[model samples]
Target: MRADGSERIVRCNEMMLSLFQCSTEKDFLELTGGCLRGMVIAEDYRQISAQLGVWQREKSADAHYLDFELCTSAAHVRRVDMYLRRIEQDGEAFWSIRLMDANMRTLMHVPGAMDGLLSRGTFYQEALRQAMKDRDMHVFGSHCPVYFNITNFKLYNASCGYAAGDRVLSHTAAVLKEMLPGAILTHLAADSFLVLAPANRLTARVEQICRRINHFIAMPGVEVKAGLRFFEAGDTSPVTSSFDEAKMACDAAKKVVKRSWAIYRKSMSDRVVLHTYILTHFTEALQKGQIKVYLQPCMRVLTEKLSHVEALMRWDDPQHGLISPAAIIPVLEESGLIHELDAFMIRSVVKLLHYQKENGLPIVPVSVNLSSLDFFEMDPFAVAEEIMERYGISHEYLRFELTETAVVRDKGTLRQALQKFHRAGYHVWLDDFGSGYSSLNVLKDYPFDLLKLDMAFLKNFNQRSRDIILSVVHMAKKLGIHTLAEGVETEEQLRFLRSSGCEQIQGYYYGKPMTPEALYAACDKGTYSVESRAESHLYYHPLRGHILRQIRKVDASQTAQMMTFSAYGRSYRVTMKRIASAQALHIYQAKFEDITEELQYDDKVRQTDDVMRNL
Candidate 1:
C-alpha cells in the first residue's frame, strides 16, 4: 500500500513498483529477456562465487527493458489480446510482443519482436478460441496475473423488460470499469459488455470486482447476466467467432433459469466455427455464379445413352476451399435452407430444360432428390409443375424421385399430393428402392412409374448373388415398372444389367455426374471426364496412399484430416474429392482473420469477419 489511504496502482517502472508494501524485498526484481539476464535465483556457493568474480552487469536507467518475465495462463493470453484490442480501439499501437508462460518460462524470445509479427501470441489466440468453442474455457496458453477474467457473458434480467435490463447492464459495466481501470470495455450488443484488463498481481483486485458484480446482481431490483472469459496477457482470440456464442449461452439461460448472470460456454466446435464462415461464402458464391450446377446424367446403360441429368449443386466455398452437399447439406437442413438449394437447382434445370425444348433436342428425363422436410412444406408436384410450365417444359422432360423413406413416411398422402402429376403423365421414380422394405408395399399400393435401384446393392456386387439383382429387375418389369439400375460402375456390370433386362444405368463407369457441356462431351466421347472429375489422384495416392495409410496409422490427426473428401457417387470408383478442403479450420482462420470485403468478399466469411474485427 502507498502512504496515501488509496492504494497506488503499480507502475511499469521498478521505482513505482517498489513503493508497494511487499512481505519480502527478495521477491522484487526487474524482468529481462533470456536465462542469464536479471534472473532471481537461489544463492548457491558456486554461482555466488562465479557471479562475485565476474563483473556486475550494468542496469541502465534508460533500458526500461526487463530481465524478469510476467507469469501468465492461457486465460491471461486472451486478456492480452483484449488489451491490444482495447488499445487499438483507442487508436493506440498494439505492439508485437514475446511472452512467458505460467512458470515464468520463456515461450517466445522474438528478436526485434516489437517490430515483428506477433506470431507466438497468435497460437494462444487460436488455442483459446478452440478451447472456448470446445467448452473447455479453462485451458489457457499462459498463466499470467494480468488477464481480464470473464466468468460468463450472461444477461442480468432478460425476464424483466428493457428498462430494468438496461439499468442492470449500466450498473454492471460501471462496476467492472471502476474495478478494472483502463480496461477495454465493449457493449457487446444489448445487456452484455466485455472488459479486458491487465491483471498482473491483481488477482485480489479481480476477485473483488467479481464479488461486487455478484453483490450488485443479487440485490433483486435488477438482475444481471455475466460470464467470465479469462486468458493470458498476449493471445489471439479467446471466445468463439463472436460474443454471440457467449450470448447464445446467455439466451439459453434466459429461457430456463432466468438467471441474472451465467458464464459463457466454450461449447461450439471448430466445424461449427468454420460453418459460420462458409455460410457467408455460399451466399456470395450463389450471387457471383461461383455456385454452378453439375449434371449427373441419369442414363440408360444398355443403349449407352444420355437419359436426363440430375442437377447437383456444387460450390467452391472460396473461404473453405470447396464445400460439398454432404458437408453443407446438414447445415442447410438445420437452417431450413434445403428449399433454397432445391430452388436453385430447379431454376437452373428449368433453363436447361427450356433450352432443350426450344432447340427441339432429344430431351431425356432428369429428376431431383427432395428432402422429406421439403416435401412436407411444398407439394413436389406443384413446384415441379410450376417450374416446367414457366420454362415451357413438359412433364416428360422432368422425372421426380422421392426417397423410399419419403414415400413410406408420407402417410400415403404423397399419392394424393402428387396425383395431378401422375395423372398429367409425369413419371415418379421410387429412389433407393432396396433399402426400404415398405417401398414395395407403397409401389403396389400407389401409382408409381419407375424405380431406381439403391446403390447399396451395387456396393456389394462382388459378393451379392445375380439372383438378388435379377429378382428386383424381373419384379419391376412384371409390374410394368421401368427400372433404372444405379451404381453401374464396370463394363461387366453394365453388360450384366443389360442381359438381365435392366432399362437404365447411372454411375461413374458410365461417366461421372457432369455439367451440361460436360455431359455432352463425356457422353458423346466416352473415356472419362478429366476436367471436373475426382480421380483417385486428387486425394488418393497409389504408392503415396500406401505410405500415407501407414503414416496415418500412427498419426490420429493426419488420419482424421484424410476423411473429409470421400467419393460418394462411385459404384466401383466414386472418385471422392471433397468440394471443401481437408483443412477446414485452417481455411477458416486464413479466410477470416484477414478478410476485407474490399479484397475477397467471400459470402461465408463476412459476418465472421465482422465479429472478428470487433474481437
Candidate 2:
C-alpha cells in the first residue's frame, strides 16, 4: 500500500487470489479499483485511515494493528485482523500489509482481552452469571459495585494524544486487577471502568487503586475518582440501578477537591431523584412562574447606598417548597439547560428594570450570573440584547457576572464575548474572583469592569484574610477595576472594606436576596437607599485613593478624635475612630471634612489649632 492508500502488488501469493476469488493479479487489481482502500468496506476504511493518519503524524509506532472488514469481489464482508508497518526506501514511504481471518467471538471470549478488562457488554453478562452463582451460595451481598471515572481524561488525551491515553487506560485496568485480585472489571468507555469488588476494605482498596493509577500515569491535572455502592442482603435492585447509584456518587466526588472516592449514601439517592425531577420539570417550572428572580442589593462602600442588585435564581417548586440554587444550578449546568435559565434571568431583570422606570422607582443595574455553557450552548449576548430592546432597557441597567471558572473554560470565546459586551456599553464583572487558582492570570488576560471578591475570604475572618482582601482591593483599584466584597456581614468588615477603597459590597450585612417587589418596598421604606449615577461616579473619583491612603495611615486608636491631611493640593479634616479591632484588622470610621474653606476663618482656624494642639 502506498502512502496515498493506493495498492502496489510487488508480490502476491496464490492464497490471496483464492481469498478474493480472483483468477489473476490483474483481475484482483481491477476488482479493488487499484487501491487497498477499495478492498476495505467504506466504514472500515475510514476508521483505518484515521488511525493510520494519527500514527503517521505522531510517528509513535512503526506498526499498527486493528480488526477490519474486508470486502471480497462478491461483495461479502469478512472480518480480518490487519497489520501494517511503515517502510521507507529512498525517501518514499510505503505500508507493508498483512491480513488474517479474525473470529471476534473467540477473541472476546478470552479474559482481559479488551485492554486488560472485559468489554462493557461481556462484563455485564459475566457479572450476571457470577451474581446468580453467588446467590445460590448465599454470598451475593458480599460484593459491591464501583464506578471509576478519570476526571479530566479528555484533557490528557487532547494534550498527550490518544495513544498515551490508551496506555493510561490499560495501566489503570491492570492496577485495578492487581489491587482487587478476585474483582470483576470492565472498561466502560474512555477512561471509565466498572468493577465488582468484595465489600470488605473496599474504600481503602479503591483509594489505593486511584492513587496508584495517578502515580503510574504521572500527569498533571489527571486523576481517578471512584464511587462505590455496597450491596445489602437480599437487595433486589437491578445491576443497572446499582451502577447508577455508583455514578451518582462518582459525580459527587468530582465536585470536591482532593476527594478520591465517595460511597453511595441514601442522601445521594434522594438528591438524584430530586435532580431527575428538576431536569424533567424545568421547562414547565419556567412557564408556570415557579422559577423566580431574586435580587440582592450591592451597597456602595463610600456612600452606604445600593449601587446595584445581583439577580439570583430561586425555584419555588410547590412540592419541594424551595429548591436551592446550589441544587438546581448544577443539574441545569450539567444538562446544558443553564443557557435557558440564564436567558430567562436576563429577560426578567430587563423587565424588572422597565417596571421600575415606569413606576418612578429607583433603578440600578441588575447583575445576572452566567454559566460557562451559555457561550457554547447559546448566543447569550444576542439574547440579552434582544431582551433589553424588547423591554426598552439600556445596557447600563444590566450587568453580566461570570465566575473565574467560567472564564477559564474557553478564553477565546470569553474574550470575544467580553469585547462584544463592552463595545455595547455593558459591564462584565468577574464574580467569585479568588475562588480558583487562576485568578491572577484571568485578571491579567481579561478586561473586567468590576471584581466581586469571593465570599470565602470573609467566611473565616482573620488577620491573614483581611490582609489578602485589602491587597486584592488595592490591586483592583490600581488596575482601574472596581471591587465588590461579598459576604460582608459585620460592620467591622464594612469599615475595613471602606478603608480599603472597595467600591461595592453585597451580603447579609445589608439584606439577603429578596423578591423585586420586596426590594422595592424596602427602598420605599428607607430600609435601603439606591445610589444615584452621579453619586457612584463621585465615590469612584480619583481622589478616593488618596483619601483611602490617609484613612489607612491614621492610627484610629491613638487619634480617637479628628485628624487632618492634605492631598492633591486640598486640605481635608477627617475624624477617625476605631470601630472594631478584634480578630481581623483594625476597622476605622472616618468622616472627611473638606476644610479648604476653613482656612479663611481666623477664629475657626484658632479653634482648630487649639483642638489639634490638644490632640
Candidate 3:
C-alpha cells in the first residue's frame, strides 16, 4: 500500500481479495473506494492514523500492527488485523500491508491487547454471536450486559501519566476476567469496559469488581461505576443497543452518591429524550436569545463594595420555561456543545462590559466560567482575547474562572495559558477550590490570581467547618492568592469569612444572580457600590483594622455613631450602625465621608465667635 497521500494499493494476493469477498483487484478497489484509508471503518481510521504517526516518530520501528473493522464488498463489517511495514522505494514512501482475520488471532498475538480481555471489535462480535445463540435458549440462560467506567479517569491519567493509566486499565481488565470467569469481556477504550455477566448475582459481581479495582488502584477519590441491562427472554434488540443502554445506566450511576451501579429502567429513556431535545434546539434557542448571562456580584470583604461579578448562564426555553444549569451543563458538555456556549458567554460578557463603559456606568471586572471541555474543543484563550479585542474592552475588566477539575485536564498547557492571560493583564480565578480531592495540588501547580472557596464549607456551618474555612483562607493569603467565599447566606457565615481574612464574598448574602439591567439599577440606586480602583489601597491599609475594631466594639443598642478620624493627612467622619446582632456578635455597616473642609469651616467659625466675645 502506498503511504503517500493517495493511500493507493500497490499489490495484493488472492487471499486478500477472497477475504474481502472480491473476485478481482478492481472489485477490491471499488469496495475500498480505491484507497487504503477506506479499508478500515471510518470511526477507527483516526485511531489508526494516530498509531501510525506515533510509530513514524520512532524511526527505529519499521513495522507496526493494529486491529480494526474493515468494510467488505458485500457491505459487511469484519474485524481484521493489519501488519504494516514502512518501505521506501525509489524515494517514495510505501507500506507493505498484510491482512488477517482478527477472529483467528489469539489474544496474546493481538497488538496492544489488554491482559485477559479481548479487543473491542472481537468482543462486540462475540457478544452479538452469543446474544443470537441465547435467543433460542430458555429464559434462565439470559445474561446481563454491563458497562464499567472509571470516574475521573482522565484526571488520573493527567496526574499519573499515560503509562500509569494504561497499567490501571490492564489491571481492571484482569480483575473483571478473574471475577466473571467464562464471561465475554473487552476493553472498550480509555477507562471503559464491556462485559456480559450472568443475570443471577450480577449486582454482587459488579460490586466485587468495583471494589477490587479500587483496592488495586489504591488511589483516594477514584472509583469505578457500573451500568447494567438484564437481557430478557425473547427480546430481539441489537447487542449494540444493549451496550448503549448499559452506558446510559452507568452515566446515571455516576450522579448518585454511594451507588456504584445502576440497573437500566424504562424511566431512563426520558433523559435520552431530553438530551436529544437540548442538542436539537440549542443553536436555535441561543439565536433567539433564550440563553442569557446573569451576573452574581462579589463584594470585597474590607470595602464592602462590588469588586467584581461572576457571569452565570441561564436558559429560558419557551417550552421548558426555565432550565437550571445543573440540568443543561452536563448534556452540553457530553455533546461538546459547551464550547459554543462558552464562546457565546465570553462574547456576551465583553459586550456587556463595553456597554457599561460606553454608557458611563460603573464597570467592574466580570468573571466568565470556563469548562475543561473548552480547552479541548477550542482555543479558549484565543477566543476570549479576540472577543475582548473586538469589543475594545481592556483585559483587566474581564476575568476567567476555571474550576479545580478544569486545571487537571492538561496542567502544562493551562499553565502557559494562565501566564498568557496574566501578561495580557487579565485575572485568572480558580472557582470551587476545595470542592475536589486535588485542591492543594491545583494551587501548587497553577498560577491563579483568586481562589473561590467552594460553598460547601459554609453550607453546614459549624466550629469545625469554620476552622477549615479559616485555614484555607489563611493558606491562600500566605500564597498571595486572594480568596472569595461563595454561597454565604447568613450573617454568621459572613462574619466568619470576614474574620478569616477572606478578601471577597459572593453569594445570596450580597445578592443572587440577576440580569445585567438589574445589576446596573442596583449600582445606580446605591444598593451596591462599585469598588473604586483608585482607593483600593485604602481597603488594605492598617487603618482599616482600627475602624473594623471600632465597629466591632459598638453596642447593638446604639442606633448609630459618628466619629472623626485622620488618614493620609485628611480627616474623615465615619458613621457606624448595627445591621444585625445575633449569637452575641454584632454586624455593623459603616459609611465613611471625608469632612476636611467641614471641620476647617467649623474651627474658623469657633475662632471668630471667641474674638467677637473677647471684643
Q: Which tens-of-lDDT digit does each residue in 1-615 have in candidate 3?
A: 766544567777899998888999887765565565556644455567667656655644366778765655543345678888888889877778789875454444223436557766788888878876777565533778898999888788888998888888878877887888778987765667889877778899899899888887777767899999886655666776677678778878988878999998765655554544565566667999999999999998766889889999999988777777876787677555689999999999999999998999888789999888787779888998898888899777888999987786665777877788888878889999888878888888888988898888988898989989878977986887878899999998887877677878999988999999999999999999997543343444456566666665567336676667676567777777777766644456667687889989999999999999999
Q: In candidate 2, what are the lDDT values of residues 532-608, reduced to their tens digit?
A: 65444444456556555655656543555655655555566766566656565556565656776776586688999
**What clash count does candidate 3 reach?**
0
- Of the two candidates 1 and 3, the one with more favorable TM-score, higher being better, is 3
Q: lDDT for every model?
A: 0.49, 0.77, 0.77
Q: In what order do the candidates fall by TM-score, top score first?
A: 2, 3, 1
Better of 1 and 2 by TM-score: 2
lDDT of 1 at 1: 12
Query: In model 3, which range of ten residues has the least summed lDDT?
Result: 104-113
Estimate the lDDT of model 2. Answer: 0.77
lDDT of 1 by residue, 1-615 (tens): 111111121223343123222223333221211121112111111233233223223211121222221111111111111010111224422221222222222233222211221233343354344445434554443222122222222333445456654455556556766766644444433333444344353456655665676675564433344434345434455343333334433333443434433344454333434443343344445778877778776554332445566667787765556666776766555444466677677777778878766876545456877776676556666677777778777666666777887778777567676677778877677888878768678787777777888888877776364678788888986787778878878888876777676767788876566678766555457633222222212212233254334334434443222222223342111211112233321110000011133333455578788899999
Off by over 4 Å in 3: 1-145, 148-200, 209-225, 230-243, 251-260, 265-268, 276-284, 302-304, 319-321, 327-337, 372-396, 444-447, 521-590, 594-615
Model 2 / residue 463 / CA error / Å: 1.8
RMSD of 2: 15.3
RMSD of each: 27.6, 15.3, 9.9
Stronger candidate by TM-score (2 vs 3): 2
